[model samples]
Target: MREMNYFIVGDVHGCYYTLKKLLQNWDSDRQKLIFVGDYINKGKHSRKVVELVRELQYRYPGTVCIKGNHEYEMVRYIEDGTKNSDIKENFRNTLMDYDLRNKYRDDVKWMKRLPLYYDDGDIYVTHAGVNWLGLRKFKENSSWCVLRYRGRLKRMSRLQVFGHTPTESKRPEFNKKSNAINIDSGAGNFDNMSAVLIDDAGKIRKIYTEQIRKEDYH
Candidate 1:
């Protein structure tokens, strides 16, 4: 119970309603919230999701977020303009509601400011693994395994927690290493959401769910 003291959530994937539900009683002054990225896309409420994040930033002031590949693609679209493969249309459409079409490009700039890595004395967090090697022989820096997984897991300094690679299930598995936890069980289209919390000792505790009938689940 005496641990990381923060309740960190994983890629919300535009499920603002779910996030709101999960965040009930969250007190910023007591327990901090760390969002592991991918707060938008693939769900129907990207604007709502982003707005919640914006408001939280204002209210909480020192909250933390990491850069997910989705946000990276968003930066690319803003910087060099979109190509056919920036991301999916539905996702872009969701963000379009936020009017990220240049005049509001600052939102993307804000997103891009998120760092590729973080170490919290007791944990490391990222959207993907840290490919010390960048995008050469290994997968691109955008891949979850590198930008979200490695940067946090490879070291013994702290527990690593992340999102980005959607887990197929909603249960806790052994972290990639004894010290890292992956919590991105897809919240985009599923009835379940997932997360990981670390204790002061850097031990991981999983917060997850099982599929229930949609009627009973929501």
Candidate 2:
């Protein structure tokens, strides 16, 4: 049982360079990279981001890549071409970015199996915040909960961290009232990319993409 630090990153919507910058100092051997989903769509290098995540997961054990709504739509579009309209319009760009528009079956298959959330007693990580009804209701809602629920959530026994709703603020959104942290400050919503480091006891140390690209720091 190797000791590992938990690092959660929210929504990497095709910002390949930004994601690269964020991981430049990451210690994969000792830190677990938990992505809170929405890894694709809205960015130019969606393929590269996916590839990088796969590569990192291969190099590091305990790395968790939970699925986002975009992934769910991508899987649907891949499985049934006429399934989703929004994704269908942007599907070519997404596939072409990786050198394929109607293929990459393996990647699609990989995305399909991504879990919706992860919990480890003290912290809860999901693509979106759990609704006010609580965890049991969240489980019952499943994809709806992970993909659509919004606003401040009710406080739970553990800290809840999520990233589906993008915030205009440059920093990750933290709600003291609900004990929820939103890390989706990335270019997915045309803002800076943010990543948070959580210690074994659930303390947060946040870093934004501009830390390395200081010229863009605002």
Candidate 3:
């Protein structure tokens, strides 16, 4: 079997232009693109970002899109129509984006089916890093631990890559203690989106970033 390199993307959070620009570095012929979710909300182009992600999946058969906390919250909002003001506030931009495009129902369905994580033996990609004892629990319950956990991660057998809590430096952060990486550059909330290239051996080769364009978030 051919060993495929991975381009693990961070939390997109609806920065379509930023994602579009960063993806320019992806080499589809040799690299499998993996998105660590949070594709919508917080920014202005949630609809466009989702559409682009779908298009990439359609065109690239091996693309992996893992579910993030934002996606989980979105599903809950659609299903419960909860009166929680915080949830409503968090989803305001995304809801408006999909409402204008009339794609909320369909998009929610797609988001619901997304897997919580992606593991390729050599590397494990998820929205949040699970603790040493939490992996099995995360699988059994699909709980918030996998989607929202922000504590220090335990070192795993394989390299762990995740994005949820944005890096304070607005760049990918590597933790030698846990052998993990956090690639969320806070695209929707900050100025840039980030991605990391990992080789077949699970070693991060490089980091890529794209500045969020005003048109993408305004």
Best by TM-score: 3
C-alpha RMSD for every candidate: 4.4, 3.7, 2.4
Model 1's TM-score against the true structure: 0.78
Q: Give one digit per residue, the lDDT tens place, for model 3 in 1-218.
A: 87789999999988888888899999998899999989988888888888899899999979999988888788877777665465568586567547622445788888889987788699999888776666553652355467877787878888999988888898999998899999998786857899999999999999998888887755
Task: Give one digit per residue, the lDDT tens place, for model 2 in 1-218.
Answer: 77667778878777777888877657777677899988777777778788889988887757999888888777766677653344555565676555433556778888888887899986899888787766453452354476657765868777788987777676787788888888887556557777887777777765555422332222
Query: Mind giving the per-residue lDDT tens digits that candidate 1 earns over 1-218?
Result: 43236677777777767777767645565666788888767666666777788788888876787767677667766677666466578556765666676566667778778766667677777775444344431233534354444443353556667666666666444454545566776675565566555555666644644332233223
- Alpha-carbon deviation at 61 in model 3, angstroms: 1.5
What local lDDT score does residue 35 receive in model 2, on the 0 to 100 scale?
91
The parts of candidate 1 lying over 4 Å away from their true place are 1-4, 83-87, 131-145, 148-155, 176-178, 205-218
Candidate 2: residue 148 Cα off by (Å): 2.4
